[model samples]
Target: MTIREHNGVGKVTWKAEPDAHDYPAAASYLSLIAPGAQAGDLVGQLQTASLEHYKAKDMLRASGLPLLPPDNPHVAADLAKVKNNKALSPVLLIRGDLTLGIALQIADGYHRVCASYHLDENTDIPCRIADHPGSRVSALAAAVGGDLVNDSR
Candidate 1:
């Protein structure tokens, strides 16, 4: 869906298939951070994100697409194996405009994206998208923080 300002209310133009590759950086980052977040909540957050922040996140995700040596090589290797085996997980989290903005600010899922790239340079995993409308970066960050805490154990 495309988001535009119309008559003061935000306008969303839905598409049959979302262009995952075309996703804005911030929203994508939020999806990576939340993993399985609700679409509605994500949209709400995206709507609230500042344009500059959103663009910054998008640039970060894009720049990190290529994996370099000595940085999470194990994860990168795991991604490669998954790609080689054709067994990469299908579940993905996609976000709309607002959540995308918040994600850009938090820079979530750098490792995961890098790993995914390492595994299969051409793989496009299925994503479950969120559409945040009125959320903030701190809230998204908190959600990511919780995930980190949970994964640490």
Candidate 2:
């Protein structure tokens, strides 16, 4: 994953080929990366949730990480759900080249990353990053690429 600037806002973006290794955790994180979502808020919640998941499990495999005591009860509860399932959908945060700068600074998937720290703790998430010089060209290019650009002005 990489951070980039886009439309005067900082954003997170990723680029990776679709593969089996990618998981739901990444997808979940991507859903929350939006204009209004705060990085700190999401990261905290994700970490708490991951810890909660760890605590509930009796014995985790070598692939999993142990849960740590949580500062907030609410997060613990959310993480419990994740733990019970033993599997999560991957969330992805992706942006064209232009937004890479913003995404990196904001650390778009910070929450999920934090959560991963407690859950898997050793692996990196699947991030699909794109490279756009800046919004002026990237945004416009994305629109054109998607066929959303009607006016050529």
Report lDDT (CA) for all predictions. 0.37, 0.34
Q: How high is each candidate's TM-score?
A: 0.32, 0.30
lDDT of 2 by residue, 38-112 (tens): 433333333322211121121122113234443335335434534443333233233323234343321233334
Highest lDDT: give the candidate number: 1
Per-residue alpha-carbon lDDT of model 1 for 62-145, expressed as tens digits?
343445442566565544544344232222233323434443222333444445444334333232333233445345657777
Let me know the TM-score candidate 2 reaches against the reference structure: 0.30
For model 2, give the 10-residue run with minimal summed lDDT. 50-59
What is residue 110's positional error in candidate 1, in angstroms?
Answer: 5.2
RMSD of each: 15.3, 16.2
